[model samples]
Target: MSEHRILKLFFFACLGVFVLHFTMTLLHNTPEKYLTPRMESYSHLWCYPTFHQGWALFAPEPQSKHKRMEMRYYGPSGWSEWYRAEHICMDQHIRYRVTHYSKLCHVTQNTVYHLWMAVDHFDQQDRPAEQFYPQNMGYGIAMVLAENYAHHFLPEMEVHTLQIRLILEDPFELQDPEVIHFPTKTLMDGPE
Candidate 1:
């Protein structure tokens, strides 16, 4: 075969591989445990770059309320007063620390939301939160928050125990806000 023909054949072969990889990725629904190591690696290499995983950025789920993080640290006597992990900026100056922490909370919240959706879809048919959500999800986010809390706020305070509360607020309602507390042991245990 001529050199030009050989090059054309090679190009077509590469194109074919790319198409196959992309198609498999787009349609991939198999759980990781079933995939061989090589197959898993191949999927990671090809699929991750091509796919942008997330819900619609412009249109999110309907939110009647907003949630914020509140934390209390271990103190000499007992737990310190609960304070907002997120900063409240009254000044005009941009608070980058606040912005960064807020973004972390946002990401963690979204991660938990996605995990909840998956659990809801699969296992919640018969039994709901009692069966699966707590055991399977939110540990990663909890660890991230705990470590960040220690590193950022209570480095000198020797924070042995941390309690984080998710405070949900409704703008329209005058009623008391809802507060959900994460387990202190889970926060201290670090990521699994």
Candidate 2:
């Protein structure tokens, strides 16, 4: 091959390697894990750290036998930034909570703040099989993280809430503070 052609090929090879490495690193750092009803699905209980954003999350119990999932948060700016997600089971009268939050900021200054997402899911059941206790879905722990954004924004800002949604594969992008909702359900008693 000519000198110019060889140089171009080398450049492309290097670029590909860099991209691969970056992608792998991102997945590794995220620490994704699969969990079932028997085991607690929570990975990192602490604030899910991210750049130019803040987080508060919790892996909660399914309101019913169905709708089991890992709820997560994503966005920029921190405050009473409460965001929630409901994983509606394919076909079952169940609504549960899996609260997961993320945040970012400089480690030096306590310049940002956030709060625990409230009982994001409604407790219409009032009580489940184990009567008495108000069994419902909500933020188990108020996770907080420092969002670093030196590369993007000028003045440091902690994301209070993330514009959450149902994406099979959602990138960690900055979004508005909002909750993602789906049809909720409750089982009914009948003479069957």
Candidate 3:
């Protein structure tokens, strides 16, 4: 193959990767923050606690709300600006059954991590959608029961629970992690 052909092939490969990544992100029911009323004033901050103890396997259980959404981290000032109704959205499934609980993570200075708000809820067809409405879409909580990576799938010695904390500052972090979430306890019942 000619040098030009090789370069062309490499360009196409990169393009393909980008497209696939974008499509997957959209399918994951990404919150269109750019379209929100708070976009002009929104910010995010985050953190991840060391989980050498064990992982908290979260899932939407019976008699609970099976819902999750992105909770952008903002400093104390930004958090103060947030009103429960103005900032967060619901999965509707939990509208009548369970109350939702959410908390933001705090990381060490100069540190970064993915804030696992929740995974996108998949439909009967296994497609991502909150309902019939694309805007209502979001991910469910990922079940993390412990912290260990015995599987070769993870880099040896690097297989450990992520100490990621995501902060959604108005400026936003240039890079971030893609952590997932799963519902834990029902909020309606209150205190475990």
Candidate 4:
């Protein structure tokens, strides 16, 4: 093939890959209910984290409430003072401005968000919120993350158990801040 023809073929190939990738990405980001089974299976296998995309930037229902996470650890000396995860994570981000700092923020925020959603789902189903813990992915991950955060920040203290609290502050609504207290999770066997 001539040099120009080779270059033209390469450009077309690149464009085809780009279009195919994004089309799959778009399909993947869509809700499973809206996608056919074949498409859903294709997207699930192909578009996990590596090719996945988030739609938070174009959020149709923007989050108006500011969520905060706090935790207290129970040890030999009794419960420690409540430590704010947001403050610690934000401080790290402000000082370092690195991916890890931002990820810390995600970990804290995701725990609160997922737990809140889990509780809401249980409520909607007319099930006791307490019952959700056994099968709740959010509860499982939260326990692990909460324990990790406790260890990271309070290395000297032996944390026997910890409880996480989620505070929802809506400045836009001017409503009283709502607080949800999660059950105290034992760290005896480590995270569930």
Which one is best on lDDT? 4
Comparing 1 and 2 by lDDT, which wins?
1
Q: Is candidate 3 or candidate 4 better by lDDT?
A: 4
The clash numbers for all candidates, in the given order, read 0, 27, 28, 0
Model 1: pairs clashing at backbone N, Cα or C within 3 Å: none
Q: What's the distance in Å from true for residue 177, model 1? A: 0.6
Q: Compared with the true structure, what per-residue lDDT tens digits does model 2 show for residues 1-192?
A: 899999999999999978865654454456346343222212222222322123333324311111212222232332223222221221111222232112121211121111111222233434432232223222111122211221132234333332222222222334433333322211122111
Give the top-scoring candidate (TM-score).
4
Q: Give the TM-score of candidate 4.
A: 0.60
TM-scores for all predictions = 0.45, 0.19, 0.20, 0.60
Q: Give the TM-score (vs. native) of candidate 1.
A: 0.45
If the candidates were sorted by their lDDT against the true structure, best first, what order would they fall in? 4, 1, 2, 3
Which RMSD values do the candidates have, in order? 16.6, 19.5, 20.6, 14.0
The TM-score of predicted model 3 comes to: 0.20
Residue 152, candidate 4: alpha-carbon lDDT: 81
Worst 10 residues of 3 by lDDT: 141-150
99: Cα error in model 4, Å: 6.6
Least accurate 10 contiguous residues by lDDT in model 4: 48-57
Of candidates 4 and 2, the better by lDDT:
4
Model 1, C-alpha of 165: deviation from truth (Å) = 1.4
